[model samples]
Target: MPDLFLLNISASSIFDAASPEAASIRQLTFEFIIAASAVLLLVVILTSYITVKYRSKHRHEDPKQITGNRALEIWMVSVPLALVILFLFRSLATMNAILPDRGNHTPDIIITGHQWFWEASYPGTTVTTANEIHLPTGKRILMLLNAADVIHDWWVPALGPKMDMIPGMNNYLWLTINQPGIYDGACSEFCGQQHAWMRIRVIAQLQPDYERWLSEQTTNTHIPQDTMAKAGAILFLESTCSSCHRLKGTAAAGITGPDLTHFGSRQTMLTGMMANDSGNVARWLSDPQAVKPGAHMPRFIFAKDSIRALTAYLEQLK
Candidate 1:
């Protein structure tokens, strides 16, 4: 639900580490920066001294030309070796802290990456959703990551470390939120033309709120109340939309696309491309390619009445 103006404050940023994993990364980054700065200062000082002392004078006499000094060579070799050892140890420590092997790891959530979107499924529960993910604060949540199609990367800079989602393989990531807020991210790996638009929104709330949200998500699709919504629901089921999307407690069940069980509950459409309003929803239904070029969702060419009805039905899904 973050707008362009709010992104600067809400978007996931590496500098603002908000979890244990991200904090570790930030600490290592700071150490590297400090070491690099010290090395740069030393190099600059030595270069300045040599430049000033060995400058060509107005006199014709030439300065002493000699081979490299043994002390200088030894200093160069020993300093580089010491820094390499230090960095290696620090890096290994960080890696171990982030990826400890606890024999037969189990995950709390399973997230699958697709060509243009993300799907989240709660293990041992009937909760499935797309694009927007919810997490609770003050818990170390292990996530099982996979890709349905090509390679994709899940990266929320503020939440924790980023990991790859490779096809035919599984990856693991740990997310532990420190605060209750919204964090935005995107597909760090380019998989297709719409990769930049493949946005991720994480809603971190308290335990009670997260449980309530999960309960809602576990419920089936909402029933239509009005005549227009009724028609829209029928149209959605009878049309091609049913072939790709799934709406629980209904005949529409497909695995090729994102689930629309609680479509109205979401804030954005096309994986966070636009606002989920009546106009935008109708517009997207009318022609998806016009709204998002190179998108996988095909254009339906729906009539005005049909589009309006579908939009109304979807809006009341929550």
Candidate 2:
């Protein structure tokens, strides 16, 4: 059973990305497996020996009573104490190795976790995106995490450990992806009814690809724009959305909600609780309360045509 369990755990894909942090975790896991297996094997062998050696047959035979053996007691205590100290040192080293150093050249990305969606930004580039984050492979990313309305967590299993996104507070972590790939993660904190839907995708790409994506994201592509998106843009300007959202090169400037400047480019919307397709955006814009109860965004069902037009515009943001 122990071997089977260890095999199963080892077989799982926990070392795909090969990041520095992942390497540390892998080392610690190996130490734990070795120590735990040794302990279990000793217990099983000792128990079996005692059972067979203590078996009795004569009715008049009295079992020998043995007091505690000093040497045996000392060995047991010292062995476990040494093992525990080793584990502690390993854990501390892993923690320090994964955390970002103040002097390290860590790329800073601001992330705001909402009730069900994730918002990310590069202040220097003035680029905002949701759900998906693009990073240059093999480079460290230092994320400054926060929550706009409620608590959320940033967790990428293959990358490193999880960090909390608290309101009015700052939490940070450093991670580096070894290669280009998309990793799946979810908000580990329960913020609202849609907490289960709070998913995020981490995309690590080659440096050139990442730079190209970044340039494209920063460039405004509203040319030959659809009338719906344009009309929606206007309505969005006049509505309460402008009070919470901020869209560069537009009149919409607010920070109470997610940035919508490049919302259309994102793969998912509503904090990764829904696809970025127009239908979901329309439905959400029409009635946020119905689709996601307790959502901070109020329902705008009364403006059906206007919302449809606005959703079309927002969707064209790509």
Candidate 3:
């Protein structure tokens, strides 16, 4: 089983910086923390000392009134002003380093956000996948983001900053992964009722492994010749399943939903909300809304035998 806790955590706990871009952001964050803590401590100490030293001794007598001291005023204003300028330059330098540069030789990927799922496709190739993206390590990746319906934010804390996917517009972001591992992310924007489940998974692999995965995805879906799987395939085309989903090199060519060219090969389903297994897939097919409210997929009333056959057929898609 995958570690669910590590897959879902607050953005502030970005300690596992897997990429150089993320590490740069983490370093700046720590610098800001240290500077803010020092200022807070100084203010607290001075407040305490002044309060006790100037306490009222008698109710009738008033303390000596005096105008503000020039030295104290100058110190108060200059200290914060200097700190502000220091942080400003530091932030600008970090941004310059992390910003996307078109001069570099980077592979471009298009990412389109729907109501609750993500679709990724490689440019100049027929390789289209959903929810999960495979990337090559030690290479800069340029992502062009757009929204199909509403505004959505693509954010992977271990990669880089968040970029908004706006309708009728395109936004770009870049990241270079130094390590090979799985990084989890989600839509930072509140798109709709099921926005919380709009999750994503990025698998950083070596150059050779990434090439193999890409080749596999570009190929057609495996056509099973077994008795039950063949029947399930017939039923899938006869029913409404093909209306919203698509399977490469098959009659199902609809694009209203995620492409199911390699559904069984994926680690999770329903935008990474549940494990992609026989039991989970069957459950989701029976009632999608029960698993995720406000999901675009309607509740399918499949018979027990039909469900089993479909599950078996889908599991062989790998």
Candidate 4:
């Protein structure tokens, strides 16, 4: 059977057990739904039967009020208690299976949740990027999640369990993707006005592809050859843009915003809020607040030529 959680057919069937941890969660969910549905069906049937069998037309006089029978009372109490106990044990078993195992030798990645973005860094390396996370399929990865500001939740329903990125505290989770695909996620916890726009995308790639991607990300930013792009690069450094954004291999090493070393390679920008096209890039540069309300990037009242040059320079970063 097709995995309902991973299928991108419909919104209702979008969630999938794409990883081992998520599979256990899916199993527990199925068990709970089945159990609850059976109980509901039983209650509905009994209610309908009792209503018809003891209708007013069948018995005009008041039915004899008998104190609850000992068997009936025992069943009423014990059945629900037994069911609760059963579900409790099942849930405990599922939890045990999904818990992070410290003994496993997995690649560690630090995930820092900022106010409206996600930054992922590979341990023991200078590689750092924003919004998108890349993972190698079929291998366990240990994610150390933390928040730079307020609380945020790192959740990819198709990949694994949701974990809270709390300020000053590091929480961890293990995930192993079984397939190569791009999984969409978002911040489940409300942190600020742009909480809903805090999105994430995890790209699970083959081991070789993931390694290549990592190597590319670590490389220096692409140098523009055209006159317009070169001019824009100069302008970027001269203006306030270099104060917040960083471009590797360049003198712009500000860490207040997303790293733009490989900006052109990304599928989306602004934490996946919009496509990484020249038009959107220009729009964002013209008025950031108009594009994304409460965004830390201030609007730049640059001329149309400057915006076009900036967009061209950014698009060549790949």
Q: Write the per-residue lDDT of candidate 3 for residues 1-318, one digit (tens) a residue.
A: 544634533233366787888899999999999999999999999899999987777767776788789999999899999999999999999998888465654447999999889999999889999998888999888888999999999988888788899999988887898878888888999999999999878888899999999999999988988988888888787898898889899988888899988888998888878878899888888888888989999887899889888888888888
Candidate 2 per-residue C-alpha lDDT over 82-145 given as tens digits, one digit per residue, 9 for 90 to 100:
9899889889888888884656554478888987678888768968876788878877778889
| C-alpha RMSD of each candidate structure in angstroms | 1.9, 5.9, 2.5, 4.0
Off by over 4 Å in 4: 1-15, 58-60, 101-107
Off by over 4 Å in 3: 1-12, 57-59, 101-107
Best by TM-score: 1
| Residue runs of model 1 more than 4 Å from their true location after superposition | 1-11, 57-61
Ordered by lDDT, highest first, the candidates read 1, 3, 4, 2
Task: Please give the clash total of every predicted structure, in order.
Answer: 0, 3, 0, 3
Task: For residues 191-303, write the lDDT of model 1, one tens digit per residue.
Answer: 99899889888888899999999999988999999999999999999999889999998999987899889989887778878777788888888888888888888887788
- Tell me how far the alpha carbon of residue 14 in candidate 2 is from the true structure, in angstroms, after superposition: 3.7
Q: State model 3's lDDT.
A: 0.86
Which candidate tops lDDT? Answer: 1
TM-score of 1: 0.94
Candidate 2, lDDT over the whole model: 0.77
lDDT of 4 by residue, 61-100 (tens): 7889897799999999999999999989988887777774
Which pairs clash in model 4? 5-15, 5-16, 6-16
